[model samples]
Target: MANILLVDPDDNAFLALKGFLACGGHRSTSVSNARDAMVFLRENILVDLIFIELKLPDSTGLDFLRTLREDYFFQHVPVVFYASKTTHAEIHEAYGLGVQSFHRKPYLQESIEDEVAKLEGKAWYWSFFEPDDAFCRRTGRSLDERGAALDELEPVIQSAAQAYKNVNIELAEAEKEKILSEISGFRRKVREVAVPGLEEYLSYLASFAKESDWNEFKEFAALMGYYAFLCSYRADIYKLERKAKQASAVLDRLAQNALLRSLPPHEVHALIPHLRDYEIDEGATLFKQGDVGDAMYLIDEGRLGIYVAMEDDSEPKKIGEIGDGDIVGEMALIKNAPRSATIIALKDTRMMRMEKDAFTRATIQSPQMKLAVQALAAQRSMDSIKKRAGEIDISAWSKTASEGVRKMGERIPNGFLRKDEKESEDIKREAESMDHWNKMIDSQTFPVVSDAKLKRDIAALKGCPVVGSAVAAFTLATEGMVTSLHPLMDLAEHDPGLAFQMLQNANALRQAKTKDLESFIDDARLCVNFLGEKRLSVVTKGFPRCCESFMYLNEGANWASHIKFLLATANIARFTCAEMELLNIERAAFLGALLHDIGKLLFLRVQPAGCIPVYLHAQEHNISIRESEILHMGISSRQMAIQFVENKSIPTSCKNVIRWVEEPEKATEDFDLVSVVAIARYMCRLCKVGFSGETTQQDLLPLEHSQLWNSIKDRVLQRFNVGNFEILVRRRLRKF
Candidate 1:
């Protein structure tokens, strides 16, 4: 067994490599950072090989190698730099520092074995000892005999290659038939697996086979056969993952949903694959009243408002609100009729929809499920009739008649009269308040500065050189320049203020615990890994001068709070976008969230006194900063942001995102992205990650159950393997 030292900052990666080495009869000692590796090397002198990651917590692997090479005892030790991706310059530099080999981090057992074999060949002590003849004979051969055997094998290898080519010529037609038959079998499996778009792919491959020449046909057949096998393998993996995910979702639904709870666990598990998951935005219609219901939906999250429209053309009366675990439209499926009420999402909602056919099958298979469905359907039918009867107009009755009816209604104690009266009074108060607030907003004047003036003011302020350099560095990293660390170090050297802010952010977002980073390079590496290239680039570009501007506008504590808020918002936005699968606009979302309050920064820079009055008004009224801005000044912080990026190269869609995040209802396009940013901002405030000078703790534009923790609870459970989001929040808040 070989004695090896493994140095990598990633705990998972280090453990995985260590396990692989153990399986190969090799012993490994691991340290997560350069400082620990140095201590280990000094204490233990019997290591035969060393494997290091390119990026370390305290120093680059290359730097460590240079230091190690200076030590006489370790100069000739075999060192391998195992990394994800390395540039030519980094490779050359590592070589110059006396690295014996550079290996790409392997993801397969065969690749791991190959790396171990290479390490065994380069053991420094092996050369010092002479081989024993008896041992050599037992192992198969001496050096001379091994060389002769290799010489003998070369012709045999060539002969085999020639024979392989001839076999294809001899059995071309038969081989084609065999491949076609196998492909035909695979097509049925593909369909059974239900891989989206695989049918069309197989059809295209079939066409290619028919149009090719003999030699090309053989090649195409081989390619098709391999692809089919690969798809089948992937399908198996996907099936396992899907089954695991659906099992949890199903168990949660069954535990809470009354109708589903009646069914057996095995029956629910069987039904899970047929259920379709959907995410609906607030104010979006699920189905209209009197529409044919093709599916029944179970609410897994958020609230759905059930409304009944009057025949007299009056506003629709909201019958009730149904929340998580409430099943809707089941009656429609059973009766084979229209839906009784319109269901609309009152907030962003998640649901699992089971079609009529699947529901029928489930009911048919489980008599208990059928009985439960019938009982619930009958109960809903009775409730629907009562709700419709209550909606009848009673204004035509005389006062005396109404009083007599009210006395009679009290005797029965239906409870509708008292509830309606309470609701009416609440609605009246809300309407009056809105009217007064609207008048105040209308009376205010929103000053619009010319673009030229805004540009001049922005130029006059000292920019954060570190942030600018990070942006430049991110750009270069994307273009395949030196590691992301190079640009970060350059930026740190240029401006320590920006570097300090970045380091703070890096420490906040780190998922692992290592020694505190001692330099900008180490911090940069951590940031790059945490935020990734795309998000880091977006963040740096969005707030080019945030640190400098914060210092210029606010005092010590306030400036620090503002910086924390920006970084927290940026990280939260990234997490939200990834969880939602919004890949196309992830960068845009990250940038929009980070710079959503840029206009406030600009106001602090150019019109510091103007914001004070607005701040005071917001505090007095218990409103958000945006509302106060609109109430005191006709425009909002969003308007300032619009002007700030008006002349810049930002996408119009991204600009719309920033404009409507505070008021998502007003957004004409990209509403989902805007809502995501809005939710992320709310989360940052809810967690009290930092102070953004917004007075109100509650969201200004509210939706029921729209808080970030509520909306993303299931997602966090699935993605982060955590039961509580507070744990994630506390982990992120460590730097604070």
Candidate 2:
């Protein structure tokens, strides 16, 4: 109903107004003169509508409307003129002053009712308030021609839901990539068609309120909210996929840790997201003995000392220390018991902690992690059982050694690997490893080692611990009629246990091996020189390294591949060494080149179908493999190699090369060696001699002309300019 102010003084006019007002429930306030009407209009300037008679006793319609338009709310009010015997000029002037319409004297009540009903909704006032008439016409035209906006958005929204499903399924790598393309198409469709089409419709509907059909607009907008929800759904799907991929990468990295290796790959997959980051300052007790254990922690960095209670509680005797890659408190978490021992951070330690509840929930479905903990706890009972050489026969010790190791299940996060994927080691000899530390923690009698025990422990060890494929290395070793033992020896450098076995088999050591053995296998090449021909032959005859993928080169025929690419990298490294004229690093550089990509092999195993999330991210963003691995996994192949070999007996210079081969400036110890391997690999990648998962084609950074050239360029000889080096590399590549 309309709010009208009538200015006619005539009583007959009041009865005539009933034709529209009485039937339609329209409200009106009438005045006998312009004086009263003007007073009412001034007080209620924001009135919805106004009606006036030109034959009013005090004033004309023109004078009233002129004042309303000039001094009042300025043309914002709709006005109608109703008068008897009004002149044409007076009507023309009122119409020119923006009166909505003119009603003739004694007009039919029904005819007036039809005109008033036209103003039943705010569409009458909308014309005065919302002046975008052209846009309103356009919005209405689009609605009639294109049908509803939902017709366009509905199909796209449904396709987005389907695309999200395709994203989560375990598809082939190529198929997964195809899903990504479809997702990209969905996003483009929304941006280009769906969103643009809905823009005018939504905005056109938004400007309306108090209209009779307002409920219809509100309902339509509510339906369009699904399109809005589709927008959020698409966005959240991207975030979840990214997070899952990141968790998958974390799964792969966590699988490589030493303590968690007891858990199967699938269990680690389920557990990665639940792991909590925790830090303890140096000397702080991680957890006190007898405290209620709610969590277990895996050390990512630094060390912790195990303090067990003794008779009479003698200051919590410190028995042993565990460092990075080791886990603590599994026994407490598993048994649901109080912590048996106190753990204090020996240094500022960073660990991944998992609450019991979170652990249970994360691993409830994938129970391999739980089973590993149980198996180790059950097996740990054996740790307390002391079997001295004086107490047991030689054959018994051999048998115990054979029982501990799970040969084929070494590297982390290969959930797809089956139970039978392990080595063909004699079932009798390839048993579990008898950890001396576990026994020390159990029996508290730290004894000297035995030869049989040593062979047992080394036999249980993986070929390459952090990132090698002993299987691939073994494949390399037995590729031909001649049993090439080079991989085993090279593998021994990364794996000191492997080196110890090779050396032990040679029987050339001066002293008997001890249980407290620290690795000094810094140099891999020295293994052959140190062992004479007969001893070397003995080591060669026995190559039982079924662990990491040591990238050893035959250097004869296949040498062009396994080490040949590195030979090119080495030539560049040697040139860098000669430029500095520091000849010592040439050896380290050469060795580093051969060993640099063990991280790539490790990554390849982690996701044989390509870490699809990592792959798509790299493919889309144009990031290097190491960078992508670091983005999602928090570690790179370069860092993995560093972690694998940091404690090896290798020279510090070689470790430096490995540490900064891709990132030379980050090196703290030996910048020259870093630069050598850095520029060497950069040049080698440019040569395209072979494929390196670590270095992509996009990785041809600006290093050729970068300041790194100063480290390797010969200032005196002028032998290593970028232009000349390019020509040299291309020539070598062409000839080879």
Candidate 3:
């Protein structure tokens, strides 16, 4: 609240004296003696308070005080003088020289206070107070009016400048904040809009893959990769989608050529993530039984064989065969069923493989494909039957025939003679009353065979005793029967029992017959030859819708499809049973009619879809399981039985009825096979056997003609007996 100055040549003394003056109602300025006080007065011309020393120190304090009134700079300065030891006369002299107060030589405390009080009474003026005479007044005309106008305008200008400066600072800060916010918002949009858009595009790219669209796939992949790189600034959707699509594209292109088309789109996508390609050498086994089957194989190039064991022997059997336009080892994808067959490459091959889950997904989606795959499966089963049938021994057959001939044993029946003339007369009288019962076997329809009985018969032939000449005769007769059925009979080793069984099964399956059995057999032979052709037309024209279902095990599949197929197969087997051990074979045949091609598992290549040209037994064996698994997945164990066993290589539990019928001794144990065959045969008869009334037995015999059932008649009957065949037909008709 107060401004005070302390100046002194003797600084300590000035400070001391200033402290005493500060106690009054005024601030104080101190200066030593007179010279320093004069200089202080020159610079600071006005003071609210002041002190000076009196005596002869560099001009007396009184003269120094007097100098303040003379100079313009110090003319308005305030001052007081004091002497530590002063006479009354000296004080009187200082007061008379314009000092405000006077003190005696021994200044009493009360006197100093009275003097300081006297100075404070005049403290309002910072300029030196000069009694009333020093006050100035302007004399120009109208000066008061001009000064008043200047004062008013100065306040307006200062207010405007201050407001402008404040507004400028606020605007600058607001602009800076706005720019920062806009940048942040732009970045957010880029992530939300731009990044996700790229991902969606990438997803579409993965969907449209095809060999003809190779350029499109590559461009899309490049675009996706670029998107991923651009989105690398963050873990955005575009980057993830790009990577996923790239992997899927690889899977799609590399899959067994036609299989990807059959797979569900989503499953194809899933497999794209894990698909790997491999090149294989000729005659290489890709996998064996008991190996982990986490993935399915697709043959990209070259051929391979699927191999399985024969039921009665330890050697692996070639159940079926494959070439291009086939898929292999797909069962591992849906369930954990073990590999029942081994896939082997017969030539250097390329294969595309997918992980198991991806394969399962593919099957679960496409219904149309599921039905189409049955033909290939049935074809494979037929092939296996042919192959295994070749292994049957003819020696036992000769012995059995010879024994039947010998068993008649010289017990000839001749008309008995009467003991007397009276007996002769009685015989003459009896003859007039006698009536004959005529018994004739009428095969008005195609003759059906018992598969079960034939198997047993062949087994019986394996060890029975026979002369070499009889064996030769039996073998020749069987060959002749096959030759009469079809021309293609020459391409494959003919077994009468095998040929008969195929015809019976087909007849039972279709519930129809050829007007001429021989003509039908010839057609079957021609069809087989056509099937053996290795060309694209076989798949596109011959297989098309029929083979589509074979691709259920790709990565992106129709979801949850495999379960339905498995359930359907199981339902037929279970519901058709009249009793636990007795299934209506005709109804089962109808149920399995669609699945006759299940043996195609044997033909799958270790590569993608292709057939192996090599004759390695192991490769052929695996083809059986691969195809079986594809057609009827629920019978994995049965497929394994067929693959590993040497004889008629079907599982005892599933195919036992055939075993019992083939071998009468096993009848009690294998009643189910008997029952099923019986019912199937009955169903075939109901459909009406296929020969026309105009077709003679010779015309019906196997010929060069191409009728469906003509070629395999002999083989069919050998396996299935006439009795079981009739029973199967009757049983089915009863159901209807």
Candidate 4:
């Protein structure tokens, strides 16, 4: 195994590289920046390989490479540039400086394998799946040892509990004082050590879900049980103190929301007394995964990080952050489930928590509040879940938990883990006994997702039969909350139905001389105000349910995936445009990207069923979907979309992008716009955000190797954070 040194400030890159090394039978130590890398190198003289990013906070990767070359000990050490920010000149300079390889961002398993195998002295031969593999077997034994240690700790915890009981029941003064001392020591142990350790385990297990084998999954479930046992015994540390002084401020903020504004002043005021102010210190965890949802906190001041341990357990991803006037932990209240994500205070924070009982009572008193609360809960759940929904291997976790865990449970003291046993047990048992594996997985995970407030909410959507695309549906379902003009305008250009409806409504209002007509029809942000949520709702809902052409109507996974792809492209387009701003492509790239795949739905709607799985073939053959479209039906999807919008009120720049997106150099008037779209599409493939038919690789070439990236990367690197943009594109993939 190679002793690798990782130099990258980005957590995304660091985790990715660490996982790569761990899986490939290599040892690695990581430092965030160049100085740390150098410092580590000096201390650890036996570093075998180095994976460095080009743009470091303190110094560039090229400078680090030069620094390495300057030293006799470090010179000739195999170095790979694991980054996206590279121009031809940078690459040429890197290789000229004796760099061994350049592995691009968003790497595939094969690429990872290839790079690992290329490590000069590393042992790369290992079976990843087999249970008997050296690493797996070794890790399994270590886990057994860890489990035994937990077993040893159980009796001590039991002794502490008994001591508390003994002191409380009645005891001599000396004995009582001794028991009290034991209780205090136990409190420190559980609060300072047990709680934090258990949390770290849970977070890591959550991220390790996909890679874990049956035994490891069982271990995770057992850990969950231990966590509950610890938390229950240490309840005194978690007891909340309510502050009545912040009631006025809490009431005022609560009144500002749309739901509160609709209620009568008395109804709104009645709910104020139930809110309890909570002060969370900087770095304090307000709540954790698997915690009971007794209350939901509405932020009053300071930032809170929403962390989901999705793909990597070493670091739970900070998916988003919320400040004053935002909600957290509501989904757990709505679904009546344990917390799915952990909320940690980034700074000293003040929040008003509304207990579930009071919230339920308030909603019961006001029917409008119930509907509004459910709607908000559904939106929030869907937003967080959408980012990490399909990725978690819950079925695997369930299957492992159900196997002889009955014996394990019988051994544990009855109250070991209080939650999840009754609710999730049947789902796990049912999953383990299913005949069909795929069906078992879907059903098992359904329970996990059902706790996302979707069981009730998705059922409710059956009543809302709207006629707009997913893009439009997302816009309105999210409360028609438009923060910027471009996201709105970009979304409008993609949904043909939305665009046409807006134009028709604009014309009707214009001819009638109504005040509703905005000066510009293309101003989507202003135009949306006139469109009305009710009207937009009708349009968007109808697209998936009303039309036969809308793909994956009843399939939530497929539906989410398809919509996610377009949104992913839009993200890439934003980056592409931002990068291309030097050459003066404004919002054209974003608008063009929205319309780039406009014909995909048309293909599904108009084409024969036999040939509609163009993406499947496109992926299989490693060819462009457009090429597959042309090969299958003698016409491209983009070409069909171009015809659809030719007579509509579509922007010329967008139309040109549709025309030249696949072949940007062919465009004359809209060269930069077309180029940006082309570049963005290329990125969408590279990042693998959503599964489209497009082959992300340009015929065995990476992004830096792609002709388009090489042509424009010089300018792109100056303005764009390629690593961050890749992160954003993948994040958007999970989001949509």
Clashes of each: 0, 24, 122, 7
| lDDT of prediction 4 | 0.53
lDDT of each: 0.54, 0.50, 0.36, 0.53
Candidate with maximal TM-score: 4
In order of appearance, the predictions have TM-scores of: 0.28, 0.30, 0.21, 0.33
User: Could you tell me the lDDT of residue 259 within candidate 2?
Assistant: 34
Per-candidate Cα RMSD to the true structure, in Å, reads: 27.7, 34.7, 53.2, 29.4
In angstroms, give how far residue 55 of model 1 lies from its true place: 30
Candidate 4 has a TM-score of 0.33
For candidate 1, lDDT tens digit of each residue in 607-669? 433455666566555557777776554566567666555543334555676677767666788
Off by over 4 Å in 3: 1-256, 259-271, 278-284, 290-293, 311-325, 331-337, 368-736
Task: Give the range of the ten consecutive residues with the poorest summed lDDT in model 3.
Answer: 691-700
The window of 10 residues in a row where model 2 has the poorest summed lDDT is 551-560
Q: Which order, best to worst by lDDT? A: 1, 4, 2, 3
Model 3, global lDDT: 0.36
Candidate no. 1 TM-score: 0.28
Whole-model lDDT, candidate 2? 0.50
Q: Candidate 4 lDDT, tens digit per residue, 184-286? A: 5544444333344543443444433334333443333433443334433223211211112233345556543434443333345557668787899999999
